[model samples]
Target: MNTAHKYMESTQMPSIVAKSLPKTWMTWAVFFFFCASVFGLAMRYFFIGDFPVLEYKNLLHAHSHIALLGWGYLLVTGILVFTFIQNPIRLNIYRKIFLLTVIANLGMMVTFPVQGYGLFSIAFSTFHLLLSYAFTYHFFKDLKNIKSNTGKTLIMLSLVWMVVSTIGLWAIAPIGSILGRLHPLYYLSVQWFLHFQLNGWFVYALLGLLLSFMEKKGYSVQISTPILIALHLSLFLTFALSVAWSNPSNYLLATNAIGVILQAFAYWIILKSAIKYLNHQTNLSKNWINHLLWIGLISLLAKAAIQAALIIPDVANIAFTIRNYVIGFIHLVMLGAITFGLGALALNQNWLVKNLISKIGWITLAFAFVSSEIILLTQGTLLWAKMGFIPQYHLLIFLASALFPLGLIFLLIAQWQASFQKHQLPKFIHKQKNQFKSKNTETMKSTVLMSLGAAMLLMVSCGGGSSENQGSYTPPSAQKEKVADPKGIGEIKNVDLGDGIDEALAQKGKAILDMKCTACYQYDGKRVVGPGFEGVTNRRRAEWIMNMITNVDVMLDEDPVAQKLFEECLTRMPNQNISLDESRQILEYFRKNDFERTGGSDAAMN
Candidate 1:
């Protein structure tokens, strides 16, 4: 049988049903990437920036939206569009329901950036998700009448997870809100949402889609599918167990250990499976598919390695650095694996293979992936050592950063070129002659308007005024004198507070100042959380500053400066229990600033 006949036989969907899926799926992918880009940029800024500017709380919000709404929801919608088309239900109601879901999802996407967690955003997003769930349920109910094993397995897994993840979402919003009030644990809730959306729904559905696609293509490996499924299932179960078990005691830790081992096993299985399939494939059209599969497999391995390293006692000091590796791994999966896979599917829909622009775009993107992974790994490692090397690594970092945007531009250009080569009107538009043509046009126009509105809201929210109030600065004390010729005008100079002061003592003082004074005082007396410290030495003695930093809790309770500042700022300066050496470093930093203002050399400050 020919490809069309084979597709019809494999899927229960009618011929027309098969035809509609590609357009819907491609549209969903486009929307997903657009949202994902915003999410990726927001996270990069949040993680790499200074504290309190883009606080952890705000970052968590962005992370949750991007991973769950942007990546998971959008990808699932795209894949479902394809799956439903292939399974061609003859029911017009099912078709309209799916179409309405797409429309609702688009509406939610528009509201999300503007309203954020506000009523409209919440309502629209909730509506869209519910619609998706409804559509999935209806689709699967229809599928139960079909008899294909591959189709049954794929649809069943995808639908079950869709329901599961949806339920998890209900748990997420309230839990996140409550924990957000408490903080720190708020981050844990965000993590839970991410894991549920990405691992539970998105990854599972994507795997099913891949398996379905492979089966449709008539390429079957004897051991590859089962091995791949086992690995995927193992990874999912490990993640679920790890997330479900909250404790980190001996028993919980042991369970986590077992989970990590299972993940490792999963990685090995996937890698081996990928190799087997790669060797078996004879079709050149499968090249992109193989590339995406391998990238995903390698990322899983890389993630497992990072996890294992974190668990090892010998190199546990490097655990902080593992976060960067994790981020890199996520990027590889999202951009290299998922994005590439979707792109290939889109290309196949157009039957435009081996375009120059697409090839260049992929190459540039791959370059970006490798360079970014290297830079992130290096920076994370250096950071773990408590050493600064920003200047040294700036070149590679910037180069890696350029890759994604550049590749995106090239891809967009290629897409535009491809569009010009084809007719502007869709096949349905040409065929439908008189049936609701004007209505369809209006619907399309509404979609455009809604999309534009949503885009505007996102721009405003992202670039709008800071969420926190930016009020007038109030000096901590009436005696807070501003020096006209404050120190540290040109460059910073290190100063020795005293000879007997040990490194540990300096660290203690620095820690104290970081905790207590950071919100209100900069070493150079520049205004930040508080007034800058250009002439702090002239205004207050070393002992006075030390006392203030180390005893701010008491000062807030009694001292006039503390009380006045607290009343003015409406925020208390927390005390940092400082040692002698920490107090000395702060004093030394102040002295250094003073010396720099006086045009004194580093030797003079020392």
Candidate 2:
């Protein structure tokens, strides 16, 4: 009996941590990601041909809401809880919070597509917001117990940004009601929420998680004072880029340029530190999770480079004007950086099931992400350069998109398989436990030295002592900045009309209106999807009309009269991808329509 008791004491069998992350929550989050991918695949198919039952706009609402709320919010919160909170009580609270969020997500998933921000969808969205507030409160309450200063600082800052982002969402209702949905203020509010949510909250949280992992891996990870100042300060300043598409003030553009430059500089410091740490890890292996993490890090670096490119006015304009570029960039961050990073961490922790199927799933997902990004960017570039559309673009992208759902399905099945694996202990251990007396002295003596040897091996394997590669790189001083000139980038500020409308231009413009403009507007001042164009040449300046057509999004955001029209129409105008010349031609078509109405004079001269 003594021997058995001593043996058990000497063995010191490891038990599950009291605050082990809830695998079930993570699994459900992945399932939501899979669902979001399916919706995305369906959207891609819509580009190839119309799906009668699927409302493209409503489906878009569903896809974005589910991807952001169902997958992003849930996964990020789970990761933060796993990394920071240790008390079982806090863990329980997080579990309950997770379930509530799940309910909100499911509600949005069902309601968004069915009613498109109707009462139910709004209710669910509001519920989710309230729940997030609760989560923020609880998380901060337990934050003091965290030992890692760098991680704690980042986590806290991320939560602050998360809360600040909601201020934008809350402003939306009032802004929309007062200034209309198409008002610059309304658009600014919406972008404010998104900018902070993606770049501020998500970015910081992931970095914090990374720092925590590095600390755990026995690496001395520290954010230098200069880099830290640049990183957090840049988050606030970089929001100017979100409103840059609206042709914001020169000061705003200058600030954004500075922010992006600072952001790039900060990332350089971080990248160097990460490389040094990685180099020092002699025990690192070619594990799939490690490979995934490397890919994620590469994507993060690429994201920094892309943001830095926005310092060019032309690049900034292209980013907003081209829908393909916008979508591609969002996916690059969401899938390439955020998803890959979190997925790698989950895999490292064995939270994601490890199996042949899961390996194939990761490979498929990686390939699909890369292939789809290439297609989207290539098409966007072609369009930007006034080159014609890519041949079979929609079809090729849809095929690539299909693999996302397939990969997720394989991963989901692997997780289910892990749940059913035999959980019995090794036969030898079981037999010894069964046979040994309660206090077996002999058994204890036999394993005592082995236990000590194992402890020593673990300490050596984990690599003790201060990291030798720490603080090797000095951060570069802030550079004297030159802001990019935003004039005539994507906005048309003036137009010089000739003495009379060109008859041939009117004829060409008539064809374009028939094909594109007619879907939304009528020449007879009858509103369809948008306000009519019957007397638009008289009501607005020729420059205004042309600018509105060529720069619909920016016009809707910045123009007061356009805001009123949007308020009355209760719908924002879509970008028709019309060029400056096409817009000038369309202006002539409006002139011709008004000439007939006025019986002789062209109101375009007004």
Candidate 3:
């Protein structure tokens, strides 16, 4: 009996705990939340007409908060809990706190539509804030004994900032109401809050956590930690100064500019260090890591370019490109760099690594689809703003969209195969494989099948139809005029305008519109949480339009027209700081479109 018991006890332990098991739940949550957010975003863009049960605007706001808070924040927190908290007592506390927070958040999420930002929303939001504070307290308390290291220091800083950011959440409602009164400092304060939370807390904290994981996996490289610290200090200081000083004085601007430059340098150094490390580590077979590293570097470059462009007077003329830089850059950083890294880490977990091919395929598909969507959306906006020509990338878009589901299918299959075929593999592989093999095949099968179904549903809803079917705007063959590039890169030439309007002007208009308008406006004049531009020309004169577009907030505060627009839209349009010439092109596009609609010549419209 003793010998038999000893034999039963003799089992090999896994090299790494199967952290990926928890990640599965988190991934599903993220996937659903993102889908919800995307749908809401599209609805905001495409559906402008009134609805009784819930306004599109409110629905979208709820979606945004839920997606960010519920999915993104919750997933990160869950991962942190799963990884760092090992004690049963600590784990139970975490689970209970998390469950309560989720429930309160879910209550808010569900109530928002019915309440429509009323007392219920206010109450729920307040409760949510309290829950957040509790969460922060508990999480920090748990992490207090963690040994000091660069990664941990970064994470600690991030958490502190997160606490600070949450404080802003409490002020949002009151501050928003005050802003309507044209308080001189209101916009500045709000901007400051946004910058701190987004740039200071969220980004910083996420990166720190990611870095910590990378270090644990023996994937990190030696870099100048002091330089990074200096850069972070500069970032915080500049952000604070920029916010605290309501007026955009020379000193403030210069300091902010320097801070931005330092940040760029920091990013470059980090990228170089990471690349060197990755190059040396030949054992890491994952190809996705390379993609993630490149994306991070590119995002850093994008940030620098955006900062530089903000100083350029004629940037508005190239607004389409600039708009892409701002809006698209966020996704590139968040989805491309951060989420990509997370996915890689999740896959590396013992459970997921066993089913490597499916895991890799699913992740690759997700990355490809998301990246393609961002690129296409940005490019489409730019083309409309600059050249007024939309290229035929529909097939590429469709294929990219399909890849996600296909990958998910493969993942499901791999998971299933892992479950049934575990006993057939070699001892080491079998041990690893058995870690993920479902105790009950039926339950696992149902979950996998459901996930597959969800993926399919997404594909269907997005429309599997080819881009050609939707119609493509091809430029007319015309005479081209060449001019020397103002920046001295090369000669520039005039290109044809597409079928939609005066193609050349339309193209130019598209670029300007993309830079200036895409973030806030869709092609159709529906609001993107802001006013649409369907008949903008008919309503405002050229100078008025230019001024309003360039300096919208100021106009909103003082100008009756802007104020009226704001009241109707219930959201203020932010200034793109566009120049006069670019504004003219946008105006011209509106006029051109008007003429085309009314069967009038361009000369007549002018």
Candidate 4:
């Protein structure tokens, strides 16, 4: 009845179960991710003009670092440690390393945002890097007869790639010292690490784990040697896409393009194989853990498609030029693909509580993640086309995003709340039932701890149902209560005459924009996160501009122009929630800029 990876060796089952319960790392990981989600809320605050004390750039650093090191790093490390290493001494050492990892993350959480990469942050960051090297060593040492199974081999390769990715980071200081930070080499080196870390290491590691899981269950989900080779070849070679924007030589571009295409094909093969092997488990697909895995696979497909698109130099250039596109792509992989896989695996262990509150908690986190993504992509599209905005963007997004952290808090509570009372007697009984252990005190203690997993599985087998099958799946609130176009109080209440420029209003609007909108919008005909505002008054109607500035969320929902922006630009504008007076001033500023561009009479312009 044990739900711990079904294929766990009989000898290792006791230890695995012992380490699985309490799920200390998994619970903490979710908590840290939730903490990171708070930074996501802070981003929305910029649009709502809420929490003015927030420092946008610094918090972004905190968010990214927390999500990457705290969540991604922890999940991967935990899976690797618990899955393969059975030696008590080695397991203890792994826990110590995890402890240090936690400390480093805590240090980074404090230092990175405050100083934006000072001595303390750098030390902690480097601490993580060094620990990674240690992980690589231990992982390699612990992996036994890896070549016997494709899944384990893939994991081994992923660890190697992980170490390889850090080469760039190791070189960064020297590279920056020799050439300025702006030098292509410096940035390229950073990109190298990021590219391989996510695409090469993380992707392979997650997939390998899934493959191993299926195989352990007596399924035939093997990735043939050739396909595995092709996958790795493509993964390592796909680094070209990262540097394609530098207008590399034709030979290099072609090589990179081929690699990208190959990467897609490799994934396609893997998917087909997974489906073939998991065909029997379809009946169990209703499980929430399976749901997470499916979502992860879908996101992975999307990632492959996007990477394939970048094979076209023109497409790559456009993507490179648009910052929003970059952020969207990154998040798609991080949140949608990678985190989803990790979340499912963590939940699969059955070490954490399985109850309604935990179920709702995951749903809340998922809702927040999906909502934020839609808003971000909408904003990016709008910026690309110099068009409309998301309706009530910041406020709605903030509200949705809040649920993510809230869900995590509930999940943490669930972890602690999961009962082990019935689980206690069963540990000794389970051993007698299975006859796997003796009555030694140390052995009994460890087995009892480990049997928590088996005991819960027993409870489950004896009619304690999982939330997965509690009822039919309900749609998210957004879809459940569909709004065709939110028009109430959002209607365009005023329109400018567009007759002449008002210098005072123009100046004030400019000042306000510098303070509030500079993160995305630009004024000098050069795009930052969105299109430049130069000659802005010419392309849009006076009323449209006023509505966009003051009532954009409504406009995006109801207005065709705004929808067009969202579709074409692939980024929508966030609702700034500025006052009517401020919006009117912005309109005056736009009119004056248009006047200057058109060589209108100087009196109003001056």
Candidate 5:
């Protein structure tokens, strides 16, 4: 089919159906994306300089919440309604649910930055979760009325994963409150939610939506049964990769490796299946929509390759330890793949304007994502290698991030123009349509080049600063003072131990030690990654032990005792960021353990 006929076949809706297609919802989804990008830019700015008024962690919470729910979830639901729900009543119900979701999202936007995960923010989040449940129910009910098998099973499974992912979120509060945020279970809960949402729900939904669109354009989607099973099974198994970060057993790592292999297999088979359909669409080869889809596929492949590399324990450890790697991977999936895929699907369906304006916007956005991801991964690798800073890395990242909002602004304007110019065109433009269109395209091409060139120059100029000039450097005196204490050259000044152990505190401390400390230290009189803790209570002062727990970074940096231990062990103890109270709790636990060995004589007290 020719391009125009293909578009007609894909997007030719009856007048009433077209009007009912929830264009406003799509616009809102794009607006949310723009807002999320602005928030992201604000976050990047903080790395250049401090803004104490806006807490960085709180902004992060808001950014992730809005970007995921406000933009990602909303866009998926809007497209699903457009594709599947033909009945007017069902469509109206979806509209209402969509509006409620928006309200919940707005509430989160207002509350999260102010109070983090306090009562109001949690309430808003809970409300959004309930709204999702409602959406899932209605979506399944409507799915039964549709007879098209193309992408149907995938869509259903995607929704099921969406609901299942919430189980992780619900587990977070209890784990965090009872065992503290540093607990492995708490981190595991958060990772569970993230893994399922990103790898399961979003991945499946986008793939299914793309297949559905293909079928609408008269292409048969012939996904084999094995490929489909592999896809679903891979999603469930790959969640082990998320659990691998907590330094689980070798068995779990092996399981994760298997999952990664299965995922790669599934992706390859699916890609192979889709190629036959894609190869026949010659007219689409040069289209921007096709280009975006290709970018998404390439990103997916890159993500899979990265996952494959993580099967190596050293690489997995580095990935877990480095914040940059984690952030880069998330963006790789969210921005580089899912967002681009969504944009292509939207453009294909004519939900987005197919014109020069959108083309420039998308190209700019693509450039920004690519540039920023490269910077992130490069810096992460440098850090992993202990090669230090990247020379004005934050500034470079900020400059690249600035382009995200700019591109979204162009897209927003394009959408506005589409809405405004619907069913209306000037007579002169109609008479000279080709000429006008070609001239605009040429102008836009020049504009895109200039914009990209300027961005590149800014990044290059900023990145030329010395790495020593950035936040990575710390002065000796300031570093010492950060963890210095008059009592023992560490943070803890005093520890008043009772004759007996604090049973409750000891229990909590034992939990913390199991999760955070035992990875390196052993309770038996045998050496491990760090020294054994069997007789530590008798060997070290209570204040000293507490200080080491709370101030390992500065202790290793400045204290002779810590340096001697480090030299003996030939390993630097990692700073677990244990709090003072937690350190005291750990001291109590040590006393209890030592008492068991010393026959309850409290020999350390002497």
Candidate 6:
């Protein structure tokens, strides 16, 4: 349990089954982060700044899920399990669940980009959720044995928050169904899940690790017992500020504001503990892992400050409506705060190869992360000011994002080389028993070549590129152009229902829904990419439904309901060009579905 020796060698495989498996798992997880970055770049390239590599919407789904589920989930889980699972025999079950999580993540990575949120992706997502539930249950049962109250309490609080966040995640479909994805709840549900995930589970879990690490080092994070209680309470309560966009009651607002203030103090308490430990250390280097951590701390503070600002009614109202501001803030939290914190933990634990090339690679990634944030926040601010767009913004972001993967490639190569060196060392000593063993020339040569190749590609990718063939921004002017519905097209001003169900017509409509709507909406009250279709008839009028199907763009522009849906969902429904007859058929199908769920004989409305 002596941390310096215990953790310093964590990156090196200690045992046959226990250590090696976790090492391998972490490596793959890190690689997934690298690959997720590619998906992220593709989104920026096509959607924001450059050429169409893939559908913008699909890329967005893929990128976000992969980053959050695949990378972030795996990274944090790996670190937490390896650091705490005191019983190594328990490692087998942990490994099994980890693999399940990976499988689910891979399913999302493949299916999300291809079809966005559909059957395949949702199934995988569900699998991961269930797996997480199992993992959490077992983890809590096991870690409850930890003697220290502070560490165990923080860990327990994190799991509770994680479970709580899923409430918001699962509610999206049902709530969206009830409110047509146009109500404030649809958006607020999503924000609720994310706020808890990032701020609640992730932040607290990392802090728990810090505490665990400190205890192992024979140091304790000193804060008053009363303050500790406040910290835990405030962690859950501060979520109010994040959902200020939902415009809660004044009492809720006051409570949330107090939570935020308490949270600031909570962080200070943790920071005090961290400073005590770091000041005694002498591992500072030009490699600058601490710099990334500083970025994370600053970003966390800034996020808190922004949330505090939203307590002002005018700012809350303005921020609630602006899409760019939301996107910028999310990335700031994800990339700047969580990612940097994880990276610093990895480095501090000696979980990375510390050669010059790897050092450069890590720093390069740091640069890319920082640069992308600069562009994103700058662009978001410009949008808030009604500025048109930045020149070459997408291409610039694309290039900046590419560095992330490129850095990973270097880091991976270095690790591979390190493993090779470790393997070869015995032979090297045997071959030169009478002499000194030195750096392998051939391996160093490969490292040098790899570095050169990485450098050249980074330059080509980032250098000034053509904006014409690639593309430009979404255009500020585009927002002003309202989509007007074609007069009288697919209009359903009246309804004539002679029977309970149009059996054949309903079948055909179901087929159409299967083909076209499968990506987003579902018939049975579960959300896919869009809101579930349960009680659709209750939610919208026949005419409104027809208008939405036939004239999506027009509805998105001029229809307040449709506009609200778009604002909340953050994705526009593409026009599938339904015919007048087809629209009627779909409505009849909806009616039939409602009858089946209610278990009533087919009833016709006047």
TM-score of each: 0.64, 0.74, 0.67, 0.68, 0.69, 0.67
Residues 465-534, candidate 6: write the lDDT tens digits.
Answer: 2223222222122345645332223456665656568798887777566444543565666443466677
The reply for model 2, stretches above 4 Å from the true place, is: 1-21, 282-285, 425-547, 550-582, 585-606
Tell me how many residue pairs clash in candidate 5.
0
Candidate 5 lDDT tens digits, 1-606: 698876544443232333534556777788888878877887787656656555555667788999999889988888888878776656767766776787677767766665555555677799999999999999998898887574887888889999999999999867645653444566677778888899888888887887787777787677778878877777877787666655445676677777778888877766654556666774465777888887887788888888888778667666655667878899998997788987788787777767899899999999999999999888877765546558988799999999999998988888877754534345543434444445544754564455445434433443422222211323233334454342456656767887677798987777667545543565655444466677778777788788877777666656656655754443446555568998988888888887787655235446
Over 204-262, each residue of candidate 3 has an lDDT whose tens digit, in order, gives 65556556766877776455677768657666655633342333344555666567667
Evaluate model 4: give its lDDT. Answer: 0.66
Q: How many residue pairs clash in each candidate?
A: 14, 11, 19, 16, 0, 1
| Rank order (by lDDT, best first) | 5, 2, 4, 6, 3, 1
State candidate 3's TM-score.
0.67
lDDT of 4 by residue, 408-508 (tens): 88887887665322244456445542433233325535643444444344335533322232222222222234543322234454463545567878887
Give the Cα-based TM-score of candidate 5 against the true structure.
0.69
Task: Write one digit per residue (lDDT tens) for candidate 2, span 186-274.
Answer: 66787888888888888788777777777888776788788889998888888887666564456766788899899989877876776
Best by lDDT: 5
- lDDT, model 4, position 534: 76
lDDT of 2: 0.71
Ordering by TM-score: 2, 5, 4, 3, 6, 1
TM value for model 6: 0.67
- Quality of model 5 by C-alpha lDDT: 0.72
What pairs collide in candidate 6?
49-394
Cα error, candidate 2, residue 321 (Å): 1.1
For all candidates in order, the CA lDDT equals 0.51, 0.71, 0.53, 0.66, 0.72, 0.66
